[model samples]
Target chain A: MAGLSDLRAGFDPATVKEDFTLLRNPHHDHPLVYLDSAASSQRPDSVLAAMDDYYCRSHANVHRGVYRLAEEATSLYEGARQKIGDFIGAPDPGREIIFTKNVTEALNLVAQSWGRANLRPGDAIVLTEIEHHANLVPWLMLASEIGFEIRYLRLGEDGELDLSRLEETVEGAKLVGVTMCSNVLGTLVPVSQIAQAAHAAGAVVVADGAQYVPHLPTDVSSLGADLMAFTGHKMLGPTGIGVLWGKAEILDAMPPFLGGGEMIKDVRLDGFIPNDLPWKFEAGTPPIAEAIGLGAAVDYLSGLGMAAIREHEITLLSYAMKKLEADHGDALVIHGPSRPERRGGVLSMQLDGVHAHDLSQVLDSRGVCVRAGHHCAKPLMRCLGLAATARASFYIYNDESDIDALSDALGEARSFFA
Target chain B: MPGLEDLYREIILDHYRNPRNAKELESPPALRAEGYNPLCGDEVVITLLVDEGRIQDIGIGGQGCSISRSSASLMTVSVKGKTLEEASAAIRSFKAMMSIHESSLAPAASQTETPTAAELAKMGELAALQGVVKFPVRIKCAVLAWNTLSECMAKATDAQP
Candidate 1:
């Protein structure tokens, strides 16, 4: 089998790992084998330096000051917006991209702004069972207030979304919310297909790209989503910055989400006019340094190439699955699509006779950082009959050696329990 | 940097492997309470029959990590057949023992101060759980059942009036 280390010299993780400072520093006895990138990726030196440089040179409140430093700060922040929108092939980068705290806030922005303005009592919205609480909770919160009905797209036994009744389920629904990738199972959903059906049924589609944008090549138009939400922290950028990309016409029709200084054009004693397309959604002084850091992150990923990153992850995933199955045999159960090509680089593992938390504790002792929990998707966990799962997710910095370490740790844990 | 040996003592593992009172009591005759560690999805359900002023029997249910499972098992054995006041005292002492390090950091203050020799003696087998404080995240797992039992006691007390 072609492992990550054996990949062509042009794209090498060993060289890529050097760019991240955290990987070089070992806080534990063992070297850090970070396999939790899906939670939050480690920032490269370029991204870190970009944020630091911005603070040192130009630290000013954006869009308000007429000073030179303020102009520079505003320029950097808006430049980031342009690049990020272009990253996902947004039609009009200036008008379509809205910055929020994180993906949760981004999703809430869509549901609160669009759903509140358009939806009424007895109107139906469709959400899949595998959606993160970020996607599900916002719609549920709106439905409660508006007295609308929320329908679910059930998950299949094979850990894929059951779209057999896609036409019937989304028939007259006003909106459809779905995740582009399962955070727990790593199963990639065909959003384009879902969007087609949702559009045919006169429903607008909102895709949660939190787990997908970091690991795959994304084109907003090709995705066919009216609006998409994704975070910077999970894609090699800092926390506190997220992107909400929407079609120009759709965003133009929506009302402002949060009311504050930047979101308004002119204020009166009684009422006020909302700002333009993107700023109307961005209420407060945004995360200036973090946005610059995210722009640097996009630059870093572009240099390395997203396609190469995906290929590297596929090599790692294929090797990991084979090695785990060969070494552990019936002792371990891997969730999601058996084929690596069909999924991202996330592996949620369950060891026989061992709880996910115990397994993660054991892995931690060996410096293998894996997430053990419902992964913010309790509905999906309940569907799988699992309280929790030990998830090991790969990114550009991971390789086959990390997989070996994980396998070796599993052996020790199994034997220790025995 | 305590090793796994500190967290996974043999006695704790034994209780985890063979949990005591891993069944639910009848609801009409028993008071029930549930606790959940939302971070890790570790849940512990407590059902106990409180008659007169004493706990007649106790039951443990739900699923969790080894630390939680064993802690629940140890809690049931520690409180069973004890008077209501005595069980409540055990709860206080156990919680005090859990937060011993936090209290020691302060200038010898409040009810949750470091346990005395007598209180330590009261902890008995439950003292094995002090290792949990080392891994702060797992502390919730160790205390889930204790907190649930506290709620159950509150329910039992409310029924008296």
Candidate 2:
């Protein structure tokens, strides 16, 4: 199996760390240790180079103009679709991929376009209490607009999705969409189980693979998802480029999201006709260079087997949780799921005394970075009885030693009040 | 590091271990205010015993960081017998000091926003936390209590003669 170091010429974590010249602060000489991969992944040199190469060589309008530049641009752009399709294990690249701005936009595209068209006044959109605002808001907007009832699957004591209540929540629902892995709770939902439930309810299942695809071997068929949306930035690619993959039959059934240049086959003065499959949803100038970078990121991630990445992250999470418990046992309250393998890689915690904002500040003072906020899941926050949590997430680059540093900082914070 | 200077400084730990005034006050005459940091959900309630124009007493109730809780504690202890106008002026001085006017710390500009009761309590010793301005991320922690004080004042004053 290919590993991280084998992917590149010299991908040494020690020697080839991120050269973030743009991310420097004046106070500290020590290298900033960033542990907030759930928020955004640091782009590797390869992703940057791939984008720079695309801009340098073939930078032209795709699907427009008959010249060689346009043809090349169109091929490269279409080629990214194939790459993304292959990366996510979608068989039909042509029908399976629609490039979006981000996961949020892709989810919104499904909600506004598909939900608006398919769901009527009485139809229901079943979601979980732990959904990020990206996945929840669009459906909410649709539900309010079209009068579709919204039901949420509650969480269990284990911080996992209450699979027992799945039928009750999703029964008679028109659509059931949920996250594969949580950004805050770090709990990994059973996508296959959810899909089975939704399918039994005669509802289409859309998976928020934003947190899943980056860490797991995501085969859309095996996962049984009708639609899946994810972002490039969180998976170590350039920002502003994301993917929305759906089953061909499902894609055919949904109405177009946006209309313009490339999403049409024929245009008349009266009304234009929709293009075939994926192109029907991808309107106007797509993020060409960012797509190329995402394709490169996919190559990089794939080269390092997703299983290995998952294993590494689980080990880090377990070690971090253990260390935190051992040291700050009396004071710290970790949110989401504690079981490492059950979750993805997010570790959101709140110290007993220190506010998350203050905790994040103290941690940042020591060059240990973490995200502290409501994390765009107000409903989840309410579920957990917390307004915000200080989150420290991990990825392939993060190791057990990083967890030690985090634990040390946290211990220091606890002792600061001792 | 109590013996050898740990990563967590002594002052910070002392503040966190024993939070000050973590309780509620009786209603009426107390300018009830709540300071909340929406970012972290650190909340503090402030109650002031304002007799005529003078501050008879002040106390706080809430949860938060060592800095926020400690600052609230210090504020309650510091602002006894100060007049409401004096307290309001002090709040103006503290806010200006913390926000932008650190170097000179004199009157840089007059008050633009109408401060509530909680906002008024944020003045005085609270101004000492001006160092938090340097860390933009932690600025909210420093102001969480102050904001609560302003809110308390606002709610109290709004219902007053």
Candidate 3:
């Protein structure tokens, strides 16, 4: 964990442990050890308090208001954009950060906007085989509407995207959309190379960063992504707030997604002109509270440092993989990248003689909470030739003991059915 | 060895190791139904030989968890040769004994009398699985096969008119 310790910028893991309000189980008598961060990250108390403080004192609708409360709220909202810009490596102008409801909407915005404007009939869009439905469905819909061809970048034997074929796939393609880190397989893709290659071919690169942002420091400029989408909930922030970082020129040209308040500069009987840059895309009562919450979440993550978070996660992930392979090798099969740094914290596995659901039941009884399902990554599940898998993911608050609990619970599950 | 006793009570092992009347028959006279638990991926296919509103025979097919498979075996042995109303009454009694409520949980079953162990065993070694309900996930596993029986009967009645 030395690498992780260094990345945390000296945020001592032992001393910096804060109270995560969501970890407290209201229903269970036992202290809940949550291992499902991929599903939703639990919020620390500081983040909750920030939102509470905002609502209590300075909560007001941002932009277009003349009063002091509105001015302060607007500043906070814009400040959040800058914070996100710094957090995600979008420092050119925080105005590049266009807030949406979630990653689903951000991806959809790009699909409906950029896709509609740039793509021509007979052009092709290249997507990796493991794209989450959020990334896949939008492009698929746009392709069908415009008669653009859709192609997939195949997975290698290890389920990682075939880097050998990425260059060829991006050649002459209109756009390339891929996940920075696969939600199910946890394979970290080489976005920089893909982005450079796509640019060489006059193609745009869009990265789905929902799984990547929480585990690593993602810089939009360094990533070379023309567009990227990520959500707050997955990063221990509030839901209903997502960010889409795109080059300013791309956003200026793309069509609007939602209509009404704040998105337009002037309304006319004949036509309404759109607002400038980021506001042009934001429409109809943006998620003010959630934006404030996300700002607070950014502060929390920054204090701990992304490198520290990444390092700790890699340590925990390696520990878990080793434990699963050593202890449950006969009865369980682990899936994902072999190297810890090449993936996020998601671990998918199958237990012998026990269905994922039944195993989860026994685990739940023992006070272990894990997800057992398709994980909304149906395409990836199909690629793996599995209907579902039992998953155990980790975040900052977890340690070696959580892995022990998972291993013990897995043994109990096997015994219960053996 | 933990003994099959840990998972499949002696009665469940008996049913699973030797399923009774485990065969398919002619289709038109037989009422067929499928039961599925979407969350767990357990599925059951049941066919009943109903003769003049009486279950002349009952059998099932499909693969699932241990509790579900064992429950199917017991259900086949228990419901054969019983009148429609009698089988219905037993199912009701069985569901009530399961001690569940429709208001809170989705797709609730509603027969009100809690059947005793003797009554469940009369339904055959199905009583072996009462222990499964204690494990919430297994409750659905144990009930998947029984739910198919109720569907088969219900469809059989609707077809009669």
Name the lDDT value of residue A60 in candidate 3: 84
> In terms of DockQ, which candidate is strongest?
1
Candidate 3 RMSD to the real structure: 4.9
DockQ winner, 1 or 3: 1
Candidate with more favorable, higher lDDT: 1 or 3: 1
Model 3 B-chain TM: 0.80
Could you give the C-alpha RMSD of every candidate to the true structure, in order shown? 2.1, 5.4, 4.9
Q: Rank the candidates by DockQ, best first.
A: 1, 2, 3
Kindly report the docking quality category of candidate 1.
Answer: high
Model 3 has a DockQ score of 0.19
lDDT of 2 by residue, B1-161 (tens): 01113223444445456655555667675778776776566778788777776777777776666566776776665556777666665555655545634346445443333334565455434434545555555556666666667666666567667
Candidate 3, superposed: residue stretches over 4 Å from native: A1-9, A12-14, A24-27, A144-146, B1-161
Question: Residue-wise lDDT of candidate 1 within A1-418, one digit each (tens)?
Answer: 3443546524778778899999988958899999999999999999999999999999899999999999999999999999998888898999999999999999999998899999999999999999999999998888889999999999986678899999999999999999999999999998999999999999999999999999888899789899999999999999999999999899999999999999999999999999998999988889999999999999998888888888787888999999999999999999998889889889999999889988999889999999999999998999898999999999988888899999999998998777
lDDT of 3 by residue, A70-129 (tens): 888888888888887888878655568999999999999998888888899999889988
Tell me the deviation in Å of residue B140 in model 1.
Answer: 0.6
Best of the candidates, TM-score:
1
Among these predictions, the greatest lDDT belongs to: 1
lDDT of 1 by residue, B61-131 (tens): 99999999999999999999999899988887777677733345555566445567776676888888878
Model 1 chain A lowest lDDT segment of ten? A1-10
